[model samples]
Target chain A: MNLYELTIGEAHGLLSRKEISAVELTRAVLARITEKDEKIGAYITVTEASALKQAALADERIAGGDMTPLTGIPLAIKDLICTKDIKTTCASAILENFIPPYDAAVMEKLNRAGAVLLGKANMDEFAMGSSTENSGFKITRNPWDPGRVPGGSSGGSAAAVAADLCLGSLGSDTGGSIRQPASHCGVVGMKPTYGRVSRFGLVAFASSLDQIGPLTKTVSDCALMMNAISGYDNRDSTSVPREVPDYTQSLTQGLKEVTIGIPRQYFETDGLDPSVFLAVQKAVKTLQDRGATLVDVSLPHTSYAVAVYYIVAPAEASSNLARYDGVKYGARDKTQSSLLGMYRQTRSKGFGKEVQRRIILGTYALSSGYYEAYYNKASQVRTLIMEDFNTAFKTCDVLLSPVTPSPAFKFGEKREDPLALYLSDIYTISANLAGIPGMSVPCGFSQEGLPVGLQILGPHFNETMLLKVAYNFEQATDFHKAKPVF
Target chain B: MKITREEVIHVARLARLELDETDIETFSHQIGTILEYFDTLNQVDTQGVKPTSHAIFLTNAFREDEIKPHLDREKAMANAPEKENGYFLVPRVIG
Candidate 1:
């Protein structure tokens, strides 16, 4: 197989054996991007010079006997994440040319791991939309269906992995940004337990809900990457104090008596796609046949997830984006003669329509007249949703569901219709609201031949247990083996 | 749940956006639909429960007012759209 197609596991084995140098692997990935990325639209900026320079250093270290699982591996970072010296755009015109002076905690973590960063991939502007259509840049298409959206926010990272443009990618999930794209692109996306990973360098969409996680070709790869980037970071006050575990160690152990819960509440008359339903059913059977107990559970307050998320996320966004005034940071369209004109002109030109819309709604929700009514009420609903998960997890180790109501839709299908777009993330957003870890793994394909994802969600920091079950299930199934024919 | 043009305009003002009449109606319809969909939250009962904002249980995470190593002035001003004499430049308000 080409280096681009090699799983992180295979590439690591080859690297350790001196079969492939990091520079060689990096060149192969860059070459593949040149050949294939035009159709995928997976990247906004490819830092070929910096990437090659990093790859060269990786080879030098490996030659001197220093190695990590990610050493020399080519990676695509979602543009919403900050990277030192690299233009850190939240896929918005405001930060179009803004470069951070410091690396994000994950960036520092990954660099120490010796990973070669390919460059920044595109996303929904300010992580605002359910589809990548909200990005100030061009649309990122699904590798599986060129005409369809690559789901979104983390859509570029997911597209990169699906198209084999990068070995793995880093994506931020404020709501369903990571998981939804992973579901649509037929890759693995892990939205870590909210505090599980630090948010020091991530561009905030929803302060409480935003998390940085890895998107990879397989669950095992995602787990490995998560291990590298997760753990305590003093720079991020929200970073958890829990001890980070080596996720790969327990992953191969088969699920013998683990209880995998099926939330029956998520399936009641919500107009879910029949294909996604079938795929999730098959996955449940696969888990059950592999000796895991199948438990029927209820997250009865689940339908409130989207409602809680939209209000809370926007409210947070409204505050976070206030830093982008023309006076201080980022780009400003300032031919305005007056100070107010400058602020108005700059912001109006900077943020995309979707981002502006959210900011407006959030500003009002948090305003004096309505703060208690809308934002506060939404927070209460959020509590109920998390409590539902808490109650469900008491009965079982993890919950299983479809990552999305349907697979990827046509590029323009949900662009004009915002509600239809929001509905696409119904199954995945709840985990974000609750601050839990969720994974979207390829399970099956629709009759239309597009891929579907079976979501596995677990309680906070139960990622090791979740990965064990996911890997065991993956080993028993061959769904992840399928690759797109571009 | 039914957000109006006035509501959109009011929110827009809070957000410091310069939207005209056309944008107000469009945003109202779009935001209205989204809010209506979220009205599903009204069905749930969140009685006497602590409003859970953060997923992981942690509190009092605010840091003390410590003067840490801030970025250099040149570094800070590197990305400023408009800068003047090591400061972020804006139209001077006071004469």
Candidate 2:
């Protein structure tokens, strides 16, 4: 197989068997990035020297007979993650030149696993929008259609995987940042339960809801990467302590008696595209044929999820992002001679329009006059949203829905209307609010040729169930076999 | 849905953003259009229903109150737009 198209498992087997060298594999992917990134805009920073150095070390480890799950594999990390001594820009102007002195927990884990770092992928400025157009550095185009954007925040990582620049990538999801992009790029993206992965050293956008996850071309590959990265870290107080199981071992489990819940309200909404509905409906048929019993379930608080999310996320972001006050590790406008001028100039010039809007709205909601009516109330409503999911899970093993309302749209399609862009995450936001695990896998395609995704959501810490059901559905359909055209 | 000039100015100030006349004119209309759509929140029956904020069950996680090592003041102030001695300097407080 061509180096660019190699799977993580394939690369490991070849490396251990001495059929391929780590330097060659890393060089091959670097060459692919140099050739294709101009058109796709997948990476903001390509670490050629560091990647080669890591590859050499990986080769040394193999020569010494020491191998790990990520040994000798090239992986792309979303820019939202911090890497010590490496420039981490979150695709925003504010931290344009910032170089972190500490490594994010996953970066440290991946390094210990001996993974070769390929590059830092682009993302929306602070992961604010659904479309990659919000990435101030560059826009990531879908490999399927250059005119359309790959979904945002993790868009660059998704595009990179779709274009075969890397075998796997780590992306942070606030509201479908990982899943939405994976759907657009025709890959498998998994968002583990809220605390499944550590957030230490992550460039915080929304503290309570943000999570790190894996995006890969297949379910097994995602599980493989997850095994290496998911675990408790002392640096991040929220990292869960549940035992990390062998997810790959569970992939072959058939769905003979598995009960899958179909949330009827998800696809019946007015905004859903007709083609997406047909695609998900077709996907459901395959699961039902696999001997999995289908049951209808209701998450009555679905409508309130987005409302609660907006208030809660912005409130968290407003506080989390306050750390970049130009007095610390980011850009500073030297011309501002006064204290207040420094604050205004640094922020006004550093942050983007959407970020400013959120900070403003969030600050207002948290203000004394509005606290009880907004922030406090949103917290109470958030409980109802979680309870809604908890109640649904008692009746079925997992819940399934469409990953997005529609396929990728044109560059300017929803840029003018921010609300329309936020609505794009309607189906996925509740998962974040409830802190459950959700995965998006290719289900079918729209007639216009864009890939459609089916989302399988499971209760907190029940990622194994989500992946197993997705793996079974994948085995039954050729949807994932569809490749993007360059 | 109609946002007044005063509200626009107030939000901009709260956001710590500097807005030109064009920005004010555009935002007043744009934000109004978006906020009107938020009427969807009101449409959902929330009466007597407790509002939710956090999703996870964990709460009030506390750490020891002992002072922790923070970034050095010199290093932290090095990136400031303007700094005077050990302090981050900005505009005069007098508004």
Candidate 3:
């Protein structure tokens, strides 16, 4: 296999044996990015100079007998995560030239692990849209098919991993941003339970819902990343104070005692593609053959997840995004004289169409006289959605479903219809609403050869259970090994 | 559930975003559809259901009241669009 194609585990083994240098691995990945990123549009910025420097430092660390699993592993970061001195644009023109003065909590951890930063991946502007098409920057194409989207708002990270542009990547999931794209790109992506990771220095899109996780070529790599990034920090008050267990320890083989819940509502969901249903059904049978029991469960309020998510996520986004008022960091409109005029102009010109649309929707929902009917109602229904999961988890260890209704759709297929794009996340959005962990593992491919991902969800802070099932399935199936022939 | 152009413009103003005539028309129609979809939530019986502003319930996270190092003035002002004497300079607000 090529150097760029090695998983984090494989590359670490090689680096630890002193067979290949960190600089060699970083250079190979950077060369792959330079060769393929133009066609893929997976990166917003490529940090070649800093990446090599970090790799050299990692080499020194490895030579001095101080190396972690991620030492010298090159990874892409979703553009929303703040990297000090690097231009961390959330794929928006508002912060196009903006540079952060401090690293995000995840970046600080990854840096301490001696990981090499390849670049910042692209995403939807402010992470508002389902497809990367909403990005103010370039569009990221699916590695499987260049005409289709790579999914968003973590499209770039997913695409980079799929195309061997990077070994693994960091992606933030608010409403299926990580899992949906990982499904589309045929990779493994996990969104830890809310508060499992610190949000400090992460460019906030929807503060209450957003959580950063990993997208990797393999489930073990995902676990490696989870081990490195999951922890509590005083800087982010929302960071949970609970102890993080060693996630890799849960990667056992058999699922003998595991009970997977099949949500009846998800199978009966409207617009679920037959191919996706068949693939997930086959995966269910495969787990059963591996000595796991399947139980029929019902998350009755699953249908309302999209509606609740649209209202709640956008409402939080409107409030969190109020910080960009032409005063501090990011773009400003100098042509306007008055403060209000400048604020209006800077925002009007800085934000893209979808972002502006969300801001308007969120403001209208939270407006006086309408709050009770819109925002409050949505939050109450959100409670029902969470309760649905809590009730279902009582009968099973994890819930299984298709990650998306179908595989990656062609660009512009759903771009014109915002409601359609919102509905695409019907399966994965509930995890974010309920603050539970969800993962997308490559299951099979459609007849058209597009990838299909099997989504596994577990209770809050139960990421270990989800990872075990995913790891077992991955070891049993070769779907993850099937790479997109670009 | 249908939002009119007037309401769209009103929300835009509240959001501190200036919308053009075309944008107002587009958003009016689009937001109306989304709001109509949101009307589905009313079907659920949530009479006394409490709202969940956050997924996890955690009390206020408090730290000891002590002076610790924070972002210095220069670093804080590094990304400011307009700065004067280590302060973010905005347009005149007291006029």
Docking class of 2: acceptable
lDDT of 3 by residue, B1-95 (tens): 48988889888889999999999888888899999999999899999999998999899999999999788889888888999887889888897
Q: What is the overall TM-score of model 3 with all chains considered together?
A: 0.99
Q: Please, what are the lDDT tens digits per residue for candidate 3 over residues A89-148?
A: 899888999899889999999999999999999999998877899999889999999999
**Which candidate order results from sorting by TM-score in descending order?**
3, 1, 2
Candidate 2, A244-276: lDDT as tens digits: 998899889889868989998897776899989
Q: Rank candidates, DockQ, best first.
A: 3, 1, 2
Runs off by more than 4 Å, candidate 2: B44-51, B59-95
Worst 10 residues of 3 chain A by lDDT: A414-423
Please provide, for model 1 over B17-80, each residue's C-alpha lDDT reduced to its tens digit, 9 standing for 90 to 100: 8897777888888888877776676676666767766777787677778999988889878887
Q: For every model shown, what is its TM-score relative to the native structure?
A: 0.97, 0.95, 0.99
User: In candidate 2 chain A, where is summed lDDT lowest over 10 consecutive residues?
Assistant: A334-343
**How far off is residue B24 in model 2, in Å?**
2.1
lDDT (C-alpha, whole model) for all candidates: 0.86, 0.84, 0.94
Those runs of model 3 whose alpha carbons end farther than 4 Å from true positions after fitting are: none
Quickly count the clashes in candidate 2. Answer: 18
Clash tally, candidates in order: 0, 18, 0
User: Model 2 over residues B31-93: C-alpha lDDT tens digits?
Assistant: 676555544565555577765455665655566778777667765554455567787655566
Q: Is candidate 1 or 2 superior in TM-score?
A: 1
Say which prediction, candidate 1 or candidate 2, comes out ahead on lDDT.
1
Cα error, residue A354 of model 1, in Å, equals 0.6
